[model samples]
Each structure stands twice: as structure tokens, then as C-alpha cells.
Target: MSEQTFEATRAFIATASAEQVELIAAALRSRRLALRPAPADTTATSTSSLMKIARLGDSVQIARIQPQYLSGLTGTVINTRVTRVDIELDAKSTRKLARAKQTRFEVPAGATSFVIHGVHLNSLDIL
Candidate 1:
């Protein structure tokens, strides 16, 4: 994506309604897909092997875009998609701050899993 588009997306996400964000997250999660950058050779075989490497239950470090959220948070991969990843969040820190009533970006209550979109792939780093 172009820099302009990327920034626009970030802005949109930042102001997106809770319902809208949840809807997008739900759709992405349902796919159970993961994305890998295409190889240098366009005709090369797909990166099924690489995807498998970050399989379910694998530990991963996901970069955070919103300060209200945690950055470099370690979580277990619960699902993957060609353009997104689903992770079961580690709440060791969040649990303590759950009482905060600040109106900021946050994981939904009772939601253990969250989806990271392909556009934000750079924000995800597999450990």
C-alpha cells in the first residue's frame, strides 16, 4: 500500500466505530488466514511452508499501533489468514489495567482473540 493509503487507514482505524471495527475483525478472523510477502519470483511457489512455521500455538510478538494498547505484546497464534492473523492475547499486563475507564482503543471485553490485518503486517513480527 502507498504511504498515503496506509496513513489514511490508520486514521480510519483510529476513529472507526466500535461496531465497525468489531465487524471487520470478525470477518477477518472467520477466514483463519495468514499473509506472507510474496517471494522475489512472482511465479515461485506459495509460502505455505513459512505460514506453517508460525502455526497455531506458536509464540509471536505483535506490534501495537495504538498507545492505549500494548506494544511488542507476546501472544500465541490462534489462527492465520493470507491477509491477517488471529492471536489469543496475553493479559498479564492488561488485566491489571482493566479497571481504567479511559476512552481509548482497547480489546473488547471477554475477547481473548483479535485480528491483525495485512496492511498492518509490518506491525506483526513472528518470534
Candidate 2:
């Protein structure tokens, strides 16, 4: 078995006491954490858009990169312009989506396959 990202996240969050969790939840309020749905074999809805957007709701299953796509995407997309669409795990809870950050890609209208990394994801929706 491998170290599940969500499990790791939950463990990390568990370090905080119940009071802290309540405080954190209170602070967050209704902010929906961002998430990346796992990629599927489905086809893209549109083929010629500047960016194909997607949204992943809460609780989905995902696997970390299997060492092949890790090199290209081992960090956050704080810099550089992304050119491919990707599913990511960016939730504010720091456990469900691992700090709830948004990951984006620059969808190229010319390719049929793309890979992204640093994706701690569970579910996703296509835009």
C-alpha cells in the first residue's frame, strides 16, 4: 500500500486539537475548497477554447503520479503560464484538498492527451 494523500492530510490535520479544528472551521465559514477531479477516459466537451475549466466536488478517489509525470509537475503553479488542463487537489482544509489551492492549466486545442502533477485530487467536473 502507498501513502494516501488524503490520509496524510487527515493525519496532519488531526494534530490540531478539536478546539483548533472548530476555530478553523469557524474561520473558514462557507468557503468551498477547490479540488481536482480524477481524470477520466471521457472526451473533452469543447475542442477549441482558450481554457477548459473543471470543478471537482468533495470526496473522490485519486492516485498520485506513478513516477512518470512527476518531473514536470512537482510543485504548485505559482509562476509560469500553464498550457494544459489538469485536475488538482486544492482544498483549503489542508487535508481534503491540501490547503485548498487552485491548480490550472493552459488547454491546448491541438492535443488529445495531457498529464499534470502535484495533484492531490478526488473528484472533478468539466467546464
Candidate 3:
């Protein structure tokens, strides 16, 4: 490896915990998956061929995003479109949704609901 890259790797090794390193690995894998072009049928909710049927009022969990607290937060689906779902987070989970940390989308402080793409959702109580 180049000297700069070697040094960066060394620094990363020194500063990153096991879980942090795993998160980095998972990100790389997710990125790789994102680039592949082939996808399954469109009937199921999908952004990158992930097949998890979604419907309004289904309880779901968010995944694969920033502000880690939002990941795995359970919420109820308030609306559904071909590729998007609006979730009204459970009252208990609203505390974990930090408005200041939301970079890609604007959600107000103490907001209880947010829209997410279907690929990022995992059906908790799918029907």
C-alpha cells in the first residue's frame, strides 16, 4: 500500500473499536450491494432488490442508515407508495430521533414520524 494509505490504516486500527470496525465493514458491503444492477420483480417494496412486503399500518424497524439510534427503531407504517413508506415512530422511540443529526432529510425536533424507502425497512408485524 501507499505510505499515506498505510498510515491511514494504522490510525484507523488504533482508534476504532471492534464494533466500529464492523460497522465500517458493513458499510462497505452495503455499498457493494448498492452498485449491483439486477433486481427482482417490482410488486414487492424495493430500492435495491430487497424483498419485504410492506403495507400501511404495519409495524416495522428501520435499518441501514446514519444517526445509528434510528436503526432498529420500531414504528408503524402510516403510508405506503411503490417505493416509499412513511413511518410514525412509536411514542417511545421518538426520543431516539435526533433532529439535529438528520442530515439528508429535514425532520423537526421531537418529530414522531419520518418517511423511508422500502429497502431500509424490516417488517416487524408484516401482514
Candidate 4:
């Protein structure tokens, strides 16, 4: 980290209120999932693996999603592109997300679908 940036961060923390500090801390906790670069050693996904998980109508579990609380929710694949999947979350899952994100985030009316990147989905377990 650069000295100027380091100093600025320190100065902000030095004067920030407890709530502000906590919010910053929470961001730090989720930074890895927000942007964790792959190492050079890792290889790209194979075609077969993609087929298994990227097929339309497959059931999938949400993982490493932003807002973090959305992780573990289950949904069904409604559409699939090259690297993104449009999922229609179950009614129960929609209700759970709505309640959890009501204050911190906007929950649009009749919002039950989400487009998730293939990489962010931890599992595409067939049901």
C-alpha cells in the first residue's frame, strides 16, 4: 500500500464513528469473495464440467454472492448464456432474501430472479 493511501485510511479510522468503523470492517471481511483473483496455477473449467452445471433446468445453490446473506439459497436455472445463468429463485428463497435485505438493500416488487455468473455458483446439484 502507498504511504498516502495508508495515511488516509488511518486518518479516516481515527475520526470515524464506531458504526462507520464496523461497516468498513464488514467490507473487509467479505473482500475475498468480492474480488479474489485466481492464482497462476489454477486451470480453467473443462467443457464437461460446464455442461453438468450450466444446463438449463438444473438446480443450483447460490454461493459467494454479494450481500453474502444470499448464499445457500436454492434456485432453478431458467436460462444460460456463455458464462451467466438466470435463476428463478423458489418462493421461500425469495421471501428469505427480501426480509434479509429489506433495510440494507432494495427489494424490488416481484423480484424473484437473479443472473449469477457460473463461477460464483458453488454447486449445480441436480434435483
Candidate 5:
């Protein structure tokens, strides 16, 4: 992500409402519970080809990119798409989001969602 987009995302999370955060947390938990380990297949060509899939509610640590103020932050995966993952950050990460910028704007009171793209998949380590 670019510096500008990262800043915007951080701002959004920082100003999110408590209810929103709770909802995201719940979703993550639900997803985590639903995950099932893939069955082993003798027909499979390569074991290494079997990717480590990240389901919802999985605990994850994201690597920080320099020039972005926040260092690596841990969070729960709330949602997933073809190319992006939505995460509900933990309290410490949320605080970092709040402090990412000097100026603040009024954000509607609700849930805060953050996205990390597939290109940065290497930065995401599932716990």
C-alpha cells in the first residue's frame, strides 16, 4: 500500500466505533471456528503446493513497511476476498492507528475495517 492509503486506513480504524470493533471481532471468531484442515490426498502432486489458507478469526501479525508509522501489528482476520483481507486490529494496534496522524476528522460512529492486499501476503503471518 502507498503511504497515503495506509494513513487513510489507519485513520479509519482509529476512529471506528466500539460496536463495529465488536462485530468484527465476533465475525473473526466465528470464521476461526468454522475452519477445517484440508484432508490429505494421495493424488496430490506436491505437498508444498498446498497453501496455508487463512480463514476468518485467525490471529495474524502483519509486517510493517518503512515510511508507514506503525510497526508490525497483530489482529484477527474478519473477512477475506479474492485479493484482500479485512482485519480487526487488537487494542494496541488500534491505538497506533489513532496516533498515525496529527490531524483528525470526524468519522461516523460504527465498525472499523482494515484491508491488506494479496501483494503483501508475505507480510501476514497466521498465528
Candidate 6:
């Protein structure tokens, strides 16, 4: 007896005319779905990456005119001998803020005064 073997059948779209092939190629080139996956080793261009870098120490401006009602509302210098400054924010004052919490900083003591301008405590750091 002879041994029998099975084979699976495969099918493909019939080849198109030269003009049709060119048209299909052009259509594929125009659509994102037809684009090949990017090469694995390819890195984003250095120039483009440089554009995304942010300079941490940049000049920012803040206005310091105090409102009439809160004339006495000012930052107090605590533990002058210590390098770090801790500003205690009252819970009642920050309860409305989504990230309502106290903020601390390690700023030079030479600064004449700290400014609290924004709704949050960290906003004072910019000053």
C-alpha cells in the first residue's frame, strides 16, 4: 500500500494590469493603514527631541499688589537657622483645591520675602 499525504490549498487575489497595480500602489501609499511598521532601531530625530526639552530655570513674572481686605496676609519666615522653609497652609484655606495640601521648599534664606500669589501653596515658590 502507498502512503497518502494531505496538502492545504491557498488562494490570492489575481494579479492586476500594470495600470491597476500602479493605481493600487498609489492608493496604498496615500492611506496610513497601508504604511509599513517603523523600523525597530529608528530613533526620533535629535533635533525634534531637543524641541521637547524644557529649561527648568526660566524667568517668570508675577504681580504683587495686595488686595485691600487681606493687607496682613503675608508669608512668615520660619526656622531662619534651617536651610528649608516650611509654609504651613491651613486645611480650611486649601480644602476647596483638588490637590489641597501643604507645600515646602528649600530656597535660599537671603530672599527678602516669599510671595504667595496663586490659589495653591506651591504657586508661592515662583515668587
TM values, all candidates: 0.39, 0.18, 0.43, 0.45, 0.43, 0.17
- Locate the minimum summed-lDDT window of 10 residues in model 2: 75-84
* Best-to-worst ranking by TM-score: 4, 5, 3, 1, 2, 6
Winner on TM-score between 1 and 2 is 1
Give the CA lDDT, 0 to 100, for residue 121 in model 4.
32
- Mind giving the per-residue lDDT tens digits that candidate 5 earns over 1-127? 9999989967987887754555455455556644644466556544322223456688887764443553476788877643246677776666666556634322223425443333243456788
**TM-score of decoy 1:** 0.39
Ranking by lDDT: 4, 3, 5, 1, 2, 6
Q: What clash pairs does model 6 have?
A: none
Q: What do the candidate models score in CA lDDT, each in turn?
A: 0.56, 0.34, 0.60, 0.60, 0.57, 0.30
Candidate 6 lDDT, 21-123, residue by residue in tens? 4434434444543254556796853321111111123222212323322222334322211112233223322232213232343323344434332322212
Report the number of the highest-TM-score candidate.
Answer: 4
Error of 4 at 38 (Å): 12
Residue 42 lDDT in candidate 6: 69
lDDT of 1 by residue, 1-127 (tens): 9999999988998998754575456545533443545667688665533222344566777665555354656667666544455666566534523445555536577654544333233456777
Which 10-residue window of candidate 6 scores lowest in summed lDDT?
Answer: 47-56
Select the stronger candidate by TM-score from 1 and 4. Answer: 4
List the pairs of residues colliding in candidate 4: none
Off by over 4 Å in 5: 1-52, 64-67, 102-119
Give me the displacement of residue 98 in model 2, in angstroms: 46
Q: Write the per-residue lDDT of candidate 4 for residues 1-127, one digit (tens) a residue.
A: 9999999999999999755565455455455444656566869643212223345677777765665776777788776543356677787777677777446545566776544444333344445
